[model samples]
Target: MCRWLAYSGTPLLLDTILYRPKHSLIDQSLHARMGVETTNGDGFGIGWYAPESGSDTPAILRDIGPAWNNRNLREIAQHVKSHLLFAHIRASTGTAVQQTNCHPFRHGRWMWMHNGSVKGFHEMRRELSLAVDPGLFLDIEGTTDSEVMFFLAMTLGLEEDPPQAVAKMVGLLERTGREHGIAAPVQMTVAVTDGTTVWAFRYASEGGARSLYYSTKVDSLRAQHPDATYLQELSEDTRLIVSEPLGDLPGAWNEVPEHSYGIVHGGHDSLHEFAPIMP
Candidate 1:
């Protein structure tokens, strides 16, 4: 189990969201309210797109250490600014605790992070590895099922059709798990981005997925709590999608439906049913 958050909107200092919230991601690293484990101190990572001349590749800073105790993280958070960002705190399921195992795995201009596990991952590892394209296989730098899942999506065309490719990859993963006698083959709440748009999925083979939530209508929130103060501080187009609501503001979050995927970009959002991939 892990906790993660994705931000897409006007560029702002990372600390504003990763540290300033009442219960920020760093706080959740030690006291996650809805994760399977309260503490996710195994490791952490952050990925952000920097303003460049003609490229959109995100610069990522990852470490195999507790986010709460990392002085470098605090320094960078205050200095960096980006329109798209991802931060993750890990609680290793069975993977080794190493820097490479940290989330916000990168490939080309794309970045990804996961907050759940692939059931019976050990048994399905080989089969899953064999499915990745050789090019992607060479790029895999870690041994976590999360990284494997990211490569799988890339194999199935993540850069082109993120939502569909992810659905296909998950479908294959669930099928392979069941083939190995795993009843609930997968449990994942994943988020992937290409520096421009973000795609998040909530699904489980057994139909009981982990928690995933997205912010409520930005316009609606502004109208309802016109003087919430903080609400007025952000750009009208800013949005956050996370493993859990960042705060308890009423009507500030919406639970993503089971077996569904959410796409956020250009000040708009959409959710679609996820169809399992067939063998």
Candidate 2:
């Protein structure tokens, strides 16, 4: 398991939440209250898109160390700002702790991260990998089941239709697991983006998926609590989707429903029911 967050809407410093919040990702790295393990010290990664540079692709930074004590990460959080970003603190689920295995994996314009594990990954990896498009198969860089899920999505036409591709990928995983007699083959709360748009999902093969939440609209909260200082600092468009809330701000977060996915872009947020793509 791991802890991660995705932000879009306003260009803000990374430290604003990574380090400043009461229950920030850095805090989760040591005292995670919701993950399977309370410690996610294996590694960490960050990915963000900066439109001022005229590039649509996201830039990524990853290291195999604790996020709380990384001097380089602190420096970057203080300097770099983005309208959309991803930050993750990882807890290995049977994979080596290495930079390549750290998340926010990227392929051209797309970036992805996952927080969960495949029940019998070692037993089903070869079969699942063969299902990936031959060209994409070689792109695999790490041994984690997370990376395999990403490439599998690409092979299933991720760029053209993300939801469909992911659904297909999940369906395939379940089928493969059943074939191998492993129930509950997958459990994940994931995020993927292509600079302009973001998609987040929460699901498990046998249900009881990980925790995921999105902050309530800042403008609405500001209207209700007119004198709230934090609300005043935010733009109406700023949004955050995180594994655990950054703080205990009231009416500031809403849990994403089980078996659903959300899309955040511009000022439009949409939630849709999600189900596996049955063959």
Candidate 3:
């Protein structure tokens, strides 16, 4: 398992989101409260879009080291700023702990990260890999099921329709798992963004998907804590979707309903039930 967060809204320094919270992702790197593992130190990565660059492709910084102690991460977090970004800490289910195996995988103008696994991935690896588009297959650089799932969704049409493509990807995973005698094949809380809008999903083949949460609307938070200067500094559209809440502020976070997905985009967010459809 792993932990991750996606932010979209006003441009912000990465430090404010990654390290400022009481139970920040860096804190979770050593003391996760809701994850299957308390320590997710195998590796970590961050991907962010710089609209000023006049390009959609995101800049990614990843390393095969514990994020909590990575000086490079600390330095970058303080200096770089972006309107949208993704951060992930990894706890390998079985994959090698290399930089390439880190989360927040990127392709062109899109970036993705996941916090759960494809059960019995080794047995189902070949089938899933073969399902990826031939043109995209050559781009697969890591063995983690997370990356495979990303490309699988892209092959299924992520570039055009994210929700449908992801549903199709899960459908393919479940179908293949059944063929291999695995009862519950998929468990994921995934986030994907195309530099503008972010789509997050929480689902599992069996019930009990990993935990996921999204911040309450900025306007609501402002009303709840009128004196909180931080809330006032943010734009009305500021939003965060995380594997867990960054803090325990009342009315500040909502659990994403199980087997559902949500899209966060400039105050026009929406949540809907998710179901797998054969690809």
Candidate 4:
């Protein structure tokens, strides 16, 4: 498993969220408190949208090296700022540790990252890979199940209905996994963005999904932690969805319910039950 975070709200330097917090993503790269592994150092990646650039495509930086000690990442995080960003620390389940295999995979204006595995992927890779739309399949640059899922969702209609698209993607995996004699084949906590809104999902084929959390609303945090001046600096709509809380602030995080998904669109965020549908 791995650790990842998605942030959307007031524009701020990546350092603030990736390195400055009490238990920042960088810290989790070395010492994750909730992930299956205590350290996720195979590789890392960051993707952010620069709306000011007038391009819908996001900027992505990835390296096949531990994030905690990557000077390039440190330098970039210090200088880049964005209203929507995604950062992921990788601990490869089985795939080779390479830049292309890193998380926060990008396609057009969208970016995606996942923290869990598609069980028995090796046995079913060919079947699943062939399922991706022919046009989009040629664009797949990596060999991770995470990337495969992204393309599968895209083939299913991610641009028009992200939730439904993902549901169908997972459904395809489950149906195929069963045919391959593999039980409980899907396990994932995914975060995807289209440079404007973020959609996060937490689900597993067997019911026990990995840990996922979302920050409490800014206004609610203000009311609870009156002394935390930082709360005042952010927009009321600011939100964070992560594999774990960035800190131990009381009432600062809420676990995303099992087998469900959440959407963070400006200030109209909503959570809904998720159930896979056969593609």
Which candidate number would show the highest lDDT if scored against the true structure?
A: 4
What alpha-carbon RMSD in Å does predicted model 2 have with respect to the real structure?
1.0
User: Candidate 1 at residue 33, lDDT?
Assistant: 92
lDDT of each: 0.89, 0.92, 0.94, 0.95
| Tens digit of per-residue lDDT, candidate 1, span 99-166 | 99998999889999998888889888999999999977999999999999999999998888888788
| lDDT: worst 10-residue window of model 2 | 223-232
- Count the clashes in each prediction: 0, 0, 0, 0
Compared with the true structure, model 1 gives a TM-score of 0.97
Q: Candidate 1 — worst ten consecutive residues by lDDT sum?
A: 50-59
Which digits, one per residue and each the tens of the lDDT, describe model 2 over residues 1-279? 899999997788988868989999999999999899999999999999998898888999999999989999999999999889999999999989999999999998999999999999999989888988998888889999999999999988889999999999999999999999997898999999888889999999886999999989988889778888977888887889999888887898999999999999897798999999954
Task: Kindly list the per-residue Cα lDDT of model 3 for residues 72-114, writing each as its tens digit.
Answer: 9999999999889899999999999998999899998999999
lDDT value, residue 20 of candidate 2: 89
RMSD vs true structure, all candidates: 1.2, 1.0, 0.7, 0.7
Pick by TM-score: 1 or 3, better one: 3
In terms of lDDT, model 1 sits at 0.89
Question: Cα lDDT for residue 77, model 3?
Answer: 95
TM-score of each: 0.97, 0.98, 0.99, 0.99
Model 3, residue pairs in steric clash = none
- lDDT at residue 92 of model 2 (Cα atoms): 97
Candidate 1 segments exceeding 4 Å error: none
